[model samples]
Target: MRVVKRINALVLTGLALWLIGTSIAGAAEVNVYSARHYPSDQAIYDQFSKDTGIKVNVVEGDVNGLSQRLQREGTASPADLFITVDAANLQRVKAKDLTQPIESATVNEVVPANLRDADNHWTTISLRARVIAYAIAKVKPDEIKAYEDLADAKWKGKVLARTSNHPYNVGLIASLIAANGPEKTEDWAKAVTGNMARKPQGGDVDQLAALAVGEGAVALTNTYYYARLKGSDKAEDRAIADKVGLIFPNQDGRGVHVNVSGVALTKGSPNKANAIKFIDYLLSPTAQEAMATKGTSEFPVRAGVPQPAGLPALSTLKVDPLPLTKLGELQADAVKLADRAGWR
Candidate 1:
């Protein structure tokens, strides 16, 4: 009877230890509400979990909507991080007081000074250039060498762009404002608006498609869209991609404007340390490599890692020196300019 009771006590102690261990592991999880819904991120997230024991819980939604949700939830919100594509989206969140400023030596060391927020509220993870996708048949590479040329009379009714309010277009216009004052950028806006092919319908990929169909001669697009089309399994996608040529406009001047995808910490995160750890992990070489090669096909922000495969070497193109944070700063002005110019 004594031996049996001793065995029973041992089982009870083991059960309690198992329950405590389970509780601790559950507490190690971090919740993220991200607008970055890229499918390639799944493997990266999985790898992070494998490398470190912390689990990631992700809820994907539009940045504006998700930020609003966090605002409503306030301190009660479960979100520890917000990952979004446009710098403008990060600004929106910061404006609403939904994100907290975080400092990490790893982040500052890995990301460029201009790519991360000055206050350390957010940091860019990857980059993509907004460039002119010209039709080889209609225009020679020499014919379209600058973004300013899009407004030239020679290309009137030949321009292809998404709606004036697309984050990509707005960011580009904002960069123009940073490079050339608002007066010049606004003038450029009015001229470019008059050059649109057909009321600016469809996404970047659609514009490339229109270029193939001869609807437009020059389509303004981000490079990755062209890359995907060029690499697509579908013959139709590859065929459209074939007729398209890219011009990294303003190379002799301000260089091509770029947009970035960024990550930030939630204001009242319950897991701030873990969140920072996750962000640090993302900025590490392993994560940067994966994000650059497999995810968006955009240039990685960190040094040493190469830009996406098949994309041009980062060394070859002159990057615009204007800090991307300016895009968010001047976004309101850009929108108003686009509106006044009747660039609907």
Candidate 2:
């Protein structure tokens, strides 16, 4: 009888220990698939884990790469959250039905209506303006006042840009479509393409470098590239950044075009509850501010947060009232129009 009681006690203790270990293993972990490769983002994740006691598992890669991976994994995808650098990429993920609507009040309150999905599938954490960087020696500040003016004949053989296939360029075209209608935007694209300094071949940073080298007088790119260049430790890079002046085009009309780096919860996330919590944490003021200051040289999507130093204030700029949702919807059409206009 004594031996049997001891055996039973040992069995009960073993079962209790097993349950405890399982609970600890399961405690508050969220898996993230991200296209943003900045060290600052890693810091944000670290802070989030420390504050919430939620462990984060991050898989880093390109936006399209991660999107394809998510599709491949389908319902079995271990991704609890997806993050990427552009609104078009966010739209792509949302279109896959791989992201579910998040009803976090904190998100809704922190992120602006224009920077989030209508169904709340994603929320932009930071904002970057699409501005023109001009070589100060070659171009006068007053010569370029808006995006439309890039098509002016004076700029012919003096414009540098990335490929029209880039999502940033696509989004810019989408914004033009939103502001000026397809007909005018198509005309603008044709005229602008006629003005290309060279075939569109490289990223925004390269475009800026080309401008610095006098290959072109002006380059259309995100503001962050110049900011990064200005902050670069390399002497040549710093010189290139120094020679360029940022122009917030279209301020008199629709203001400058902007895009976002955002996050969403995966549709079939294994840890749905933890994912929601993570999303909430990401949209929190702390996270948004950190991203703006560190990760992308962008403006925080949260209303009251001051934009990072050196960026034009959002309030000062005459932003279009068009919802970003429209931009996402019009992306395919924008690309088609750009292609038709021979925007290489």
Candidate 3:
């Protein structure tokens, strides 16, 4: 009986030690659901782990798919953070109540107030400008100056754009609606649709390609896409970039329209503290430089980080001051207006 009692106590002690060890291992990791598809992001994660002794595990998917997954998982979700592009996408997730407000002073200080959520539910990690990429040889820069100019009768059949359903376009039109009421923005959309060089088709890169080949005189594209082409290793991509010149539209007015890729804390974040630490690390100058200057080619939200080469200075262009949260609020309206305007 004495021998049996001693064995039982030893067994309990071993089991308790194992359980504690397992919990410690699990507590040292953070799970992330990320929609930003940049390949260089892995290195950034690796660095975070090295610096802080916290492991980063990422699940990648499109914005909508991930948001749906979070909703399905509810409070049992393993995701501590959700990262995606575009204000509308972030807002969509927020609207679904999949994210909770991130109350971090470091995040607020590193990222500009305008680039963060008003309620701190989400914040921009990087910025991309939506600008007019014109065929240098075909269109003189002065002739096409503002986003509003695309709707002019003289530029009929000379505009190139992606489908209206694209989030980038939705954000653009939403900003326009914020700047000018829905009615006038709708009118602008209708006239711009009337000026299509061809039925809106392909992604921004394709639009840039079409412009390079003279399919259209001006193409609406993100600055990073142009930078990718300019900095591409392939000679053909370089040639395509060479054929195009960028115009930061509305510089004389509300400034160029800029969009963001952002991060938010999951409503049911299993590892909230670690997730907040990761968010702070991402906003750090070192991480910002890695993301912005590496393959991602995006402008860092933290002011002092250097932008990728060949992209124009962020300070030079006048940025549209409309709160990005408004982009999400007006997104549905923007899409409806585009459809009514025939911007297929």
TM-scores for all candidates: the values are: 0.93, 0.93, 0.94
Off by over 4 Å in 2: 1-8
Put the candidates in lDDT order, highest first: 3, 1, 2
Q: Which candidate is the best by TM-score?
A: 3
Model 3 agreement with the true structure over 250-277: per-residue lDDT tens digits:
9889999999989989999988999899
Whole-model lDDT per candidate: 0.87, 0.86, 0.90
TM match of model 3 to true structure = 0.94
**Best prediction by lDDT:** 3
Superposition error at 66 for model 3 (Å): 0.9
Global lDDT of model 3: 0.90
TM-score for candidate 2, please give it.
Answer: 0.93
The predicted structure with the larger TM-score, 2 or 3, is 3
Q: What lDDT tens digits, residue by residue, belong to model 1 across residues 1-344?
A: 99999999999999999999999866787788989878888788888888888899999998778988999999889999999998888877887888888779898888887887878899998888999999988999999888888889888899989898889999998988888888898888888889888897889999999999899899899998988878778999999989999999988887888889999888999989889988998888888888877777878888888677657966588988777788899999999988988887
**Model 2 steric clash pairs:** 146-250
TM-score of 1: 0.93
- Superposed Cα deviation of residue 62, candidate 2 (Å): 2.3
Candidate 2 lowest-lDDT run of ten: 304-313
**Regions more than 4 Å wrong, model 3:** 1-25
Off by over 4 Å in 1: 1-26
